[model samples]
Target chain A: MSESAAPGIDTAFPLSPEMRAAIIAHARREAPRECCGIIAGRDGAPVRVYPTTNIAEGNRFYEIDPKELADLEFRELPNENAEIVAIYHSHPASPAYPSRTDVELAFWPEAVYLICSLEDPDKPYIRGFTIRDGQIAEVTLPA
Target chain B: MASESTVQVLIPTPLRRFTDGESRVEVSGATVGDALDALEARFPGIDERVRDDSGQIRRFVNLFVNGQNVRDRDGIATPLSPGDELGIIPAMAGGSAA
Candidate 1:
């Protein structure tokens, strides 16, 4: 059977403008340190950007905020149109790229991983990725 | 005495131009805060990116020592040892709708 013909299979898609703005704003607000959040969308268009605190608190590394993640997951069940399409984070002190842990933790093959670097503050660099089982591939961000 | 561990402090892209494209820099410090201080001292003007106007750590940025968040351990006082890598990631916001 073809991949598309398989049952119980789901495919993830891209991000949208509103979602993009939310991530960017969060980054700017948290300038200097990295900020991270989630994006929900359907059919390749991002619908919402749920901002979450790094909870790394003052740490330079990023771990998804447990409360925020729980809240998002809760919200997802109610909103049929919303599904996690991307997981975004910023590199306040680094580049718009993934580190070793980033690669290792990315288990969602269908979800896009978005990263932004706030080195410039005025002009942050954003990049997208597809990480699956230790493999990494670059994805296109919405212009 | 300070711990004998040495790790590479990764600098962000925007600041890389100032550091001459240096992505990872080697520094020796016992704590995460100390290593950050060393980074700023060497880079100059880089501290502005990590701290707010009042000199406190900005809310959006996160510093990770060995995949663990500094906030859970000791904030800036998180200890570090040799072979530990520091990942500095910033929070980002997109353009406004209005």
Candidate 2:
């Protein structure tokens, strides 16, 4: 009854309607401040979005609460046999490209980094990329 | 003699390649430093990345035991229990654009 990202079957990283709305809404609700969260998946396909609190100091930064991160990575994910396939965040004023800081702080080589840009509040957009070894490859998402 | 105990280490994504893509690994040691040494013995190239030339944790890397930072405790000398979980995370932050 619902559509999701099917890895090999889809050319772009697909966000289910619910997930797409959730992320966009979160970005708007936390407008002028960045938000962080994770998207869990099974078999390399995304299934659910688990939004997390941002612990950083400013609107330009986002940090997942360590305890929250631990809980998802250590407990909930394993219980469902799911892995963190994507790490999503919002950019209050910048474009949705991995910033130098984003690339430097990207530790999960296996997970795609999703950035929602609120630069144009009325016409906000989302983009995904893989940041590994200080390099970024943009991930195309369905328009 | 401190009895050799096996503690679990949670490997971060970047270092998973050295761990054969394993997220968690069990190694035997009486203390955290010993455990890291054991990891190097088993996996090779692990301890060095974790502990630098001076044998201290790298500037941007963090090691947590049971959700607590080792630096807040006793550095590498922190003792391990039978089922302790050690988490490795690289420091993540952003610098204001100039």
Per-residue C-alpha lDDT of model 2 across residues A1-143, encoded as one tens digit per residue: 01113354223676676787789899898877887788998887789899988878877777776666766776678889987778888887888888888887876766778888888888788888777678777777767
lDDT of 1 by residue, A49-111 (tens): 777777564536666764455335433423565556677888776678777767755534456
TM-score of chain A of each: 0.78, 0.90
How does residue B81 of candidate 2 score in lDDT? 87
Query: Candidate 2, what DockQ?
Result: 0.35
The CAPRI category of model 1 is incorrect
Candidate that would win on TM-score: 2
Candidate 1 true-interface contact recovery? 0.00
lDDT of 1 by residue, B1-98 (tens): 67756887765333464466575789878888788888888888777777678756666566677666676788877888987877665433321111
What's the TM-score of candidate 2 when only chain A is evaluated? 0.90
RMSD of 2: 4.5
